[model samples]
Target: MQTLRTDVAIIGAGTAGLSAYRAAKAEGASAIIIEGGAYGTTCARVGCMPSKLLIAAAEAAHAVSLAPRFGVLPHGMEIDGKAVMARVRSERDRFVGFVVDGVHALPEADRLVGHARFIDDGLLQVGEHTRLHAKSVVIATGSTPVVPDALSGLGERLIVNDDVFAWQDLPRSVAVVGSGVIGLELGQALARLGVRVTLYGGSHGSVGPLTDPKLIDEAHRLFGEELHFETQGRVVSATRTDEGVTLRYARADGTHSESTFDYVLAAAGRRPDVANLGLANTSLELDAHGVPRFAADTLQAGTAPVFMAGDANGVFPVLHEAADEGRAAGRNAARFPHVEPVARRAPLAIVFGDPQIAMIGKHHRELTQGTFVTGAVSFEDQGRSRVMLKNHGLGHVYVDRATRRFVGAEWLGPAAEHIGHLLAWSLQMGLSVDDMLAMPFYHPVVEEGLRTALRDAASQLDRKG
Candidate 1:
């Protein structure tokens, strides 16, 4: 076998791996990145960009359909499924091209196109040929979609988020499994595009990033009114048919029903792709998620010269988080014994459904009872939302009772994506609730809704005092 030595070796050439490679190289270390799959990131190819493209098309269609409410009559509003998928695929390929080009620009000797398996803590086998003796290693192998065994029988009829962008045209019907971000976004978009959609949540109480019971209830009320979402049951059987797949769903109330759809899209979430890496051969310990045990602050795996980052670590799966972790892991791996822990940014996540959903900082479920109070504002009555004829959603901001400081927030509203960013920055900067309220809010804008929520919080604090 061909053997080589390097100061650092990074597995998987996706976001985290790429970031780690750059960081290691910047640290004056010789780093080689190994990959077994496509060069483009999950975000560029499957996760974020392409999904947003589809959502954009769905939004356009939905907006045109909603235009009649302003007393303006229109005609020729037809949604061509083939045309929609064409734009989505075309734009998606453009994004992937950019990522692949970036990879190609890197030194060819520094990139290896093969799967890497651990031979030991600092030793690895790439594909069937090369053996690498890395002084330190970073496992950034990312994650893969988790398909339940019951749906395994249907072969060609089953699809994942990756498979969606490859379609030449939108299907007539789809059965989306799971209520996570992917399921909710895809199912809602497809439904907006005039596709028959039935969303089956594996079980109730397991929706997207929102953990507060109130936000969860708001999600159920807002989304249930717009789409055919089922959270009270699970799919038990899937069988391939000539036209599509047949699904058998068992309800929580002990009843069963069957239906057929052109496709069964699995959005059940993903798992770290670390199982076959021969990690058991190493001295490193594995975590509960089956990844190597690592310090969250340093990304160091146990006491070994190994680090785990990105989706492989299962701490945070978003792109920005992956990039940050990769940077830290790579720098630390290069410096080794002199490694230092880095402070993490505040948590932030957004779901791109109609009336976008967002959460920043600690989730509602993570907060201690009576230590914090919630402030709320309903966009249904907010002036700007009403003026725009887009009045639908709720917002809640959490504040610490003792210090009256801004803590976290969950909102479902027209401009939630933007609001989430503002809140995330506030949390990261450690801004107090009074500090947020003191900021200038332009009159008659959507941001004024945020001011309203903050004012309510200030009033509550006053009452508590």
Candidate 2:
């Protein structure tokens, strides 16, 4: 077997691993990145980039169909599922190619193309012929879609984001299991593109971790207009038939229901891809879920030389967070004994569905009633929303009641993604409600709606004093 040594060995060449590699190399350390899957980060391949491409196509189709509402008469509009998917794949390939090219440009010795598993602490076997000895290791193996055991028997009838994006065509109808970000985005997009979509989830109370009552209600109202939502039930069983797959579930009301679809999308959630990594070879202790307990701020895996980052740690699954975690892990791994802690970015995430859902900084669950005050504005009557014919949803701003400082925000409205970014930046800078309200908000813009929420929060603070 060929033997090699490096200052740092990074497993998984996705966003987190690549970022770690660059950071480690910048620290004047010899780094080797091992990848078993295809190049291009998950975002560029199946997660964000390709999914957005499909969503954009779906939005265009939806826009044309709604032309009549805007005093425009349209005729002969048809969706070619195969062609739509082909363009998505063609464009997706280009993005993936760019990332792949970057890896190819790296020095041959720095890039290893094979599966790597720990032979023991500080030692790894690549495939069967190569051995790697490293001062420290960084794990950024990312995550995989969670398909429930009940649906395992459905086989090919079941689809996840990975399978969906690679399809040459979409099924005529789909049952999307989970009302989380992935489920809501794809389910709505598919429905808009003429696919019959029924979304199933735990309950109609919330989507994902969103806990704001107002935002939750707004999401239900807005998304219900786009797709069929079955939020009262939990999936219990699945079976494959000649036509497709049948899903059976029991509702909260103790009623049983079953439905069949041409395809079933399991968007339940994702689990860290750590099971096959031979973590048992190291002294690292894993939690019940088989995840290593690591410091969120330092990205260090306990007191061991190994570091964990990105989706592999299951801290935050978003791409930007993965990159940041990777850099921190790489830098810390390279500077092991002299490690310095790095602060994590304020949490920010967006769902690209219509009236895009977004959460920034602390969520409602993190804030106590006596400590935090909330201000809100309804887009139902917002000027820009009415003008754009998308005047649906709501926005809420949360602030420290005593200090009037921006704490967090949640919104379900047009341009919530943009609005969320503004709030996230403000919160990161420790800006107060007064500071944000003083910032320029254009007349009749979606952002003005955010200003209203801030002002409301500020006023509530004043009332308390």
Candidate 3:
């Protein structure tokens, strides 16, 4: 067999792998990047960018439907599903093309295109031809959607988020069986686009990583009014049929019922794609999830000359987080036994559903009770929200009772994605409630809602004094 050697070897060619490759090279290390799949990021292929494209179309259609509320009387507005899918696909391909082109610019000899398996620590087998001895390795194989065995019988009728973007046209009806970010965003977008969507959430009753029971309830109430949502839904049986697929499900009460749909999307979530990497052959320890144990700050998989980054690490699957971890992993692998921990950004996550869902800094569940005070605002009557009729959600900003510092926020409202960034920055800068309240807020805008929430927090602080 042919043999190759490198100072650093990066597996997978997605965002993290590419970033790792660049960072390793920048660290003055000879690096080679490997991939066994298409040369595009998950964000470009089926994750962030493509999903947002679909959401953009859904938002446009939804906005038109709400034109009557804004005193804009319009004629008949029809949604062309084919055209919507066509634009989504075309634009998604454009984004993917950019990433692919960057991959092509890399040295051809440094790229390997075959499945890589760990024959031993620091040793990888790439197909049958190449035995690569990597001084240090970075595993950025990313993640794959998990399909529960119960839903496996649906055959071709079963799909995932990746399958959704490949559609020639949107399906007439889709039964979404997860209520996390992917499920909520895609399910709501489909519903807005006039597709029949039935979303079945897990028993936790939480949506989009928000753990505040109040926010969760508000979310269920809001989404239930807009779409067919079952907060606690479980699938017991699924099978393919001549027409479509049949499913037996259990509701919140544990009662069994049956339903049928054109397609069943197993959006339960994703797991690190490490099952086929022959990890058992390596000496590195595995975590509860069966992935290699790695340090988040340095991205090192123990003391071995190996690192883990991006979705394969199974920490935060966000794109920016992946990129950051990739850089850390690459730098650490290049430096090896002399690695240092890198400071990470403040925690932030956003769900792109209507009136979006977001959490900045620490999530609600992570905070201890009686140590923090909650300052809330309801967009039901907020100025700009009322003006635009896009105000129908709640927001809560958490402040430390002792320090009066802005700890975090969980909000569901208009401009949540933008607001999330502001809150994240506040957390990073250690801004206090008064510090945030002192920031200027315009006369009439969604940001005023944030100001109002901060003002409320300030008032609560005054009461304590």
TM-score, per-candidate, Cα-based: 0.97, 0.98, 0.98
Q: What lDDT tens digits, residue by residue, belong to model 3 across residues 1-465? A: 889999999999998999999999999999999998888999999999989999999999888999988788889788898899999999999999999999999999889989999999889999888999999999999999988888876777999999999888888888899998999999999999999988888767768788888999999999998898888867888878776888777887878777778999988999999999999999999988779987777888888988899999888899999998888888988998888775689989999998798899877889999998898999999999898888899999999999999999999999999999999999999999988888888889999999888889889889987
Score residue 421 of candidate 3 by CA lDDT. 94
Better structure of 1 and 3 per lDDT: 3
- Cα deviation at 78, candidate 2, in Å, is 0.5
Error of 2 at 192 (Å): 0.6
lDDT of each: 0.89, 0.88, 0.90
- On residues 63-111, what C-alpha lDDT tens digit does candidate 2 reach at each position? 8987898999997588999998999899999999999999998899898
Report how far off residue 16 is in candidate 3 (Å). Answer: 0.9
Q: In model 3, which regions exceed 4 Å deviation?
A: none
In model 3, where is the ten-residue run with the lowest total lDDT?
201-210
Candidate 2, 168: how far from true, in Å? 0.7
Q: Candidates ranked by lDDT, best first? A: 3, 1, 2
Q: What is the lDDT of residue 416 in candidate 3?
A: 95
Best by lDDT: 3
